[model samples]
Target: MQTITVEPLAQEHIQILRLTSTPHLSGGLDTIAPYSVWITYRLNTGANQHTWTAAVSGYRVLRNGVTDMDAASIVLTNLADQDTTPDWLTDLIAKYTPSW
Candidate 1:
């Protein structure tokens, strides 16, 4: 099994943010996690808003919200394609990161 994280953005955070799945999978430079999961979407934005915004739009959106991993995947997938990656989101990621 794998571990995932879901974080809700608060006052300064904005909205709920999730960051899950590791970039380093069995293969090097794969299409990323959700790609295999089979969820595709699109979004366009300014350079500054690219990362996080993408995350919000195409976000995987897991079926359940009880677990952290579920929420993280949805948020990360969306962030991967977005133009806005906020600090609160990053904070969540850090909390769940292996190093953290």
Candidate 2:
């Protein structure tokens, strides 16, 4: 007879672990465009952690490279759709900004 062992399922926690953005330059110039934001967030789940990226210009969001509309709506609502930029994103941009 063979013995088998099984591990318990990991707890699920859907939270944003990290957020990053890449600003696109306008026509290869130094100017950044509002619509050229590409936001990527790490969705942390104990055993199913993954990253999602969204294009603010096209309103397209993807999870692990596949289209996820529900996440898209959530990302847009909390990030781009707001009247003002989210503080977290603003801070991230600031961190990357060079002070001269």
Candidate 3:
């Protein structure tokens, strides 16, 4: 079983967790004409949180997992600034698997 943990930098803000729910195209004419991936944003606004029950398609998915972090970062260029990398992400991982 694989998973990820996250936290917000500030107290007033919210933290969220989201993962791909489906497989989609890499790059093809049909894929270019209309994006083929599906993303579900689960928002956690402090005391409130919700999951996307119905897939809201159109974004691309990085299937290579961690090795494709760079590519995944590109897919979410708009939100890349919010990524918890190197330090923060490391802390999150440690909390989950301290022995590792």
lDDT of 3: 0.29
Candidate number with the higher lDDT (2 or 3):
2
The candidate scoring highest on TM-score is 2
Candidate 3 TM-score over all chains jointly: 0.18
lDDT winner? 2
Put down candidate 1 lDDT per residue, 22-89, tens digits, no spaces: 33121112222332222222223322222222233222333342222232223344444233434544
How do the residues 5-94 of candidate 2 rate in per-residue lDDT, one tens digit apiece?
A: 976543322223233353322221122323344555443445344333433442233324433333222233333344444465455444
The alpha-carbon lDDT assigned to residue 11 of candidate 1 equals 16
Decide which is better by lDDT, 1 or 3: 1
Kindly provide the TM-score of model 2 when superposed on the true structure, using C-alpha atoms.
Answer: 0.23
Model 2, position 64: C-alpha lDDT score: 41
Q: How many clashes in each structure?
A: 24, 0, 0
lDDT, candidate 3, 27-53, per-residue tens:
322121112223233444453533222
Arrange candidates by TM-score, descending: 2, 1, 3
Ranking by lDDT: 2, 1, 3
C-alpha lDDT values of all predictions: 0.31, 0.37, 0.29
What TM-score would each prediction reach against the true structure? 0.21, 0.23, 0.18
